[model samples]
Target: MYKLQLKPADKMPKYKQIVQSFIADIERGVLKDGAQLPTITELSGEYDLARDTVEKAYRELRERGFLTSVQGKGYYVQAHGDTKLKILLVFNKLSSYKKLIYYAFIEALGDQATVDLQIHHYNAHLFQEIIERSLGKYNYYVVMPHFTLATSQEEYLKVLELIPAEELVLLDKDIPELNRQVPGVFQDFNRDIGGALDALAKELERYPRMTMILPSDDNYPVEIDRGFRQFCRYNDKQVAVKDNATDEVLTPGTAYVVVRETDLVELVKKVRQTSYLLGREIGIITFNETPLKELLNMTVITTDFEQMGRTAAQLILEKKRIKVKNPFYTIRRGSL
Candidate 1:
């Protein structure tokens, strides 16, 4: 049946319009397989289409295996068009976890989606610009709203409100101010780090003093420091915090909670050149997991990055509007 009007003002070309409309109907199941389409003559007459225009549209549909022609009866629907999602995946920065999240996301989506990945580099102005320019261009907007600027929370929330609530999904960082208006898969940095330390309390007894290498980078979450301090206070353990670890004073009986990979390398190199054994005299616990850390048998507290990506992809596919806390765990290895 004829479903689209002859909108001459539409920027889309006439034949393309006809092609797209049918494809949309097929994907939506409004047009079913074996269903008969109106005769080209009938469509042309009723919709004011040139005979060549209708014929060309039908030919394109048939070439795409979406239509079949009967010599006497006219055209009928062939195979149904699969629903293909066009998603805009936005992130703040490309860190080590980016690759894992990206690969897992695409692998889960498979042939059902076209993901357009973009980064706003944590600039508030750039973030707003990207969202504005991409408006109405994607079926879904998946974003990681991690900002480093001292801008008020209201500013960020206002920017997010620009996106339609139903079409938006958040990743990585969760904003409690949103009041559950949208769905997200995020990490509880404070609770996660604190809980990990509490879980390893017995193992930590080997070292009476503990120090955290927390660089003064805006990107490094402040919640991590809070969590560490909270855990130490509750456990009655001696604790210290330093901004740099390159020349850190490594005490003989103290354990270290290292944050940066660069810092970890420096500390490990420093330890290897000393008398303290790796797991006995001195202990190491890193923030995130890596192959090198695994090889060195270092304990780590990390979020399930691959699983986070898969969960985000599932949310997009199902168009779900529920919040999920990604799993976080401590991988106990020889270093601890």
Candidate 2:
């Protein structure tokens, strides 16, 4: 008998656990090609599972191209499920923070998916070309659409329209232009940054002036700009946007809100150059939490990148179509 490894302690649904067990067994060659799966009645009665649960697993197995149902005979394995699922990870760029999202995504999937990572380098043309050549080759298309080009929303949509909605998963920032019905795990930059700043407003009261360091690159979300401005207006505080990367002077009485790690390094360098102290003389707020940032006792306002990737993976595994807003918060360390 083929045993379905279903653990009550596991958070995954029972039907998915059953489906994953069959896929794992097929990969391990325990369930050979053309091997018959136990009937719903048999699994239900023997394993104390509901008939609907077993049926749902078998139904998904067939839908995912892992099994074939014969008219008279039972469901048979389809070529051991070796060609079942392949995913494409279309990212704008692989930064230190995004690597966390990527690793968490791959780790959560385990052997359930084969992923191909492609870097678009914030080029819309190249992003389109990569998608064009890889069409019909993957089971799912996971895209991080953060392009710096003047490419219209229609252009991105035109390219993405080629992929079926069932196989599309948007990640990170949402293209305000291509608001399709695709499911994904995304960050609400406006709400995220606004709320984080609100939580740190008391700490921010120490510094009379707050400056935001925004890079010209498309890697950072545009919504963040709107959020920062909104927060400043609401709080009626003195704030400045340092759009140029070359401007890295650490003001003693002013706090700096930096986005990119490169800018953070520059500010830290300035901090070391002079006697300006962090969290007190020079307040520092960086985006995205990292191991090193925490060790430095730096405050950060960011979303959970691990949850972003894991939720995206879960969407693919369960074939669910839902937009999940990743949890956002602040880690109030000494930097703030």
Candidate 3:
């Protein structure tokens, strides 16, 4: 029989603590492979825990490949310490919002799985190389492909061919070429922008014109432009869509929608230099929320990144091969 200790003050349940202690002992060579474990009833009595709690812990250990049960016999250790699920997480870049997603994903997975996170920085060549190198190396591959406008769908499909579709979980943007073939958690960009604009329709009426500054160099989703146009046309509002704000003049009674952070900074600087009262003489709406944006009191259009992470983790854990459209909402601050 193995000696087990339970701490009543510990936040972890007695059964889970037993599981962790057993795993730790096994890793330390105290519990050798093929070693027999105490019976559930015996462990329950030893730890002063319920029989069901010990049984549940044993069942979890067996399911995680830490132990094996022999019919009409007893439970034995199947693995010394290799019981963690290996996951490969790939991202475009690590931004504040993406950090939220990554942390949420890690929290949702708990200690049952180990994740190796890598960033390709939106480089197509690096993306291809990383995916090819990671083939067959992980149990699951979660990819966030921020493909540029220049990259063709065929190029993406060819690179994705390296991984089995069942083992892949695409994140953020959705590719029409992949269609329903690959499982993913994607944002409905067009719907999100359009809905956000509609929600702010009453506030937008306060201004005579709205201008959307879209940088040509940035790889913003095309749906954003389409959604902006759709909202402007549908509402019969005068709107100007420009590639950059460099040449445009900032006029009072006009709202500016900026995408990139640098552009937001420039616009804010311009507003302050001219002494335009924010949310009154001129309005600002930025894409994606961050802590700094909150300090500026800027309204933002954003998707629930943490929820996206939790949903993605759940899908991977459940092995569900389905596409989920993440939720999006508008945060109203002093800017709007």
| Best candidate, lDDT | 1
Task: State model 3's lDDT.
Answer: 0.83
Q: What lDDT does each candidate get?
A: 0.84, 0.83, 0.83
Evaluate candidate 3 by giving its C-alpha RMSD to the native, one decimal: 13.0
Give the alpha carbon lDDT tens digit for every residue of 59-98 in model 2.
Answer: 9999988899998888899864364468899988888778
Candidate 1: global Cα-lDDT? 0.84
Estimated TM-score for each candidate: 0.76, 0.73, 0.74
Write one digit per residue (lDDT tens) for candidate 3, span 87-164: 889998888889999999999999878899999876778889898666655678899978787877777777777777
Query: TM-score of predicted model 2?
Result: 0.73
Off by over 4 Å in 2: 1-83, 175-179
* Model 1 residue 222 distance off true place after TM-score fit, in angstroms: 1.4
Best by TM-score: 1
